[model samples]
Target: MDNIIKANQFIQEGKLEEAAKILNEAIQENPNDTVAYVNFGHLLSIIGEKERAIAFYQKAIEIDQTMATAYYGAGNTYYDQEMFEEAVGMFKEAIANGLVEADAYFMLGLCYYNLGNLPHALANLLTATEKNPTDIDAMFQYGLTLAQTEQVDEAISVLEKVIKLDENHADAYYNLGVAYAFKEDIEKALASFEQALKIQPGHLLAGNGKKQLEALL
Candidate 1:
């Protein structure tokens, strides 16, 4: 097998030192191997060496400006560090460079949401859900964003989809309850909160929502 493949195997096996040695040798043999550099960056990132990982990703980008994977790697590191603005820029660059993965759109949505750009967040999250309909997290985020924007009916619909996707998704039920409450449908809200509590008895938000709604009714 190729050195890169062997290094990837070592990485999957949690042998970081061996993987690093092989990747270093690969880079030494062919300095222009952008793939090797990007893989090394990803391995370093996984091992908590964020600075080193960014360095390797930068090197890969320097070698090949159109390498979307390198930009995506750097974006992930920035996102993990809570540098939402930088992550948003990097993810946009990755998309511009032809990266069409749902994860890229999802991260972009999360970044925009964190930056308080609700419209952009909703747009990207909508795309993410379209790209991967089975992504429960993306659907949940989309529902939450809709609720935040006062689109309570749309939020209820999206959150219901999440519950349909995973019956035990207590958070989805909780959010659905919130949406129903916003719509002034006390009975439906109470039912949604009860379902959430049934699924997760310790769900504080659901418990509180149920109590509040009951008191109001």
Candidate 2:
């Protein structure tokens, strides 16, 4: 419990290095403590050492095959690295291993989107949004995927919902502008671009959108 307590304190203080040190020592002292390895992996991830994090997570999984969190972490690491196929495989394995979480679905959606598997991405993201409708990232990503698939109306609806939920969501407004432009609704497009610019001044995409709209006007 000493190591665990120290690790917790380090994490709470944002001392990820100290936490990883303590967790690594704990793992060395007790290699069977898969939780320590998993937490260490998570700490490494926070510090942006993705490959090391994946290795740590894999070590935990090797020691305890039933460590679903390890699989989930590995999946996220793969996804972050843009290894969509591998990420998809790992996330699916996590789900099959009963690692049910809104985040898992969200990650799966992202992987599918990156893989250009629009239908699967849409389905997974729909589940994520349903689980946590307030998830700004999920809503924005889902809307983007919908727009990519030519569902401009649906994309606008989702992006609008995101903007309503998080008024400062500049990306949502920017994407909504794109959706409106795709739908040939110049007025709505202009309004959405303005909204984005108001929230995030100098937002390049929104600025470009405004410029393009002005030309048409």
Top candidate (lDDT): 1
What clash pairs does model 2 have? none
Write the residue-wise lDDT of candidate 1 on 167-191 in tens digits.
Answer: 9999999988888888888999899
Query: Candidate 1: deviation at residue 200, Å?
Result: 1.4
> For candidate 2, what is the TM-score?
0.91
- Over 4 Å off, model 2: none
Candidate 2 per-residue lDDT, tens place, 120-154, comes to 99999999999899898998899999999998889
Worst 10 residues of 2 by lDDT: 38-47
lDDT values of the candidates? 0.94, 0.89
Clashing residue pairs for model 1: none
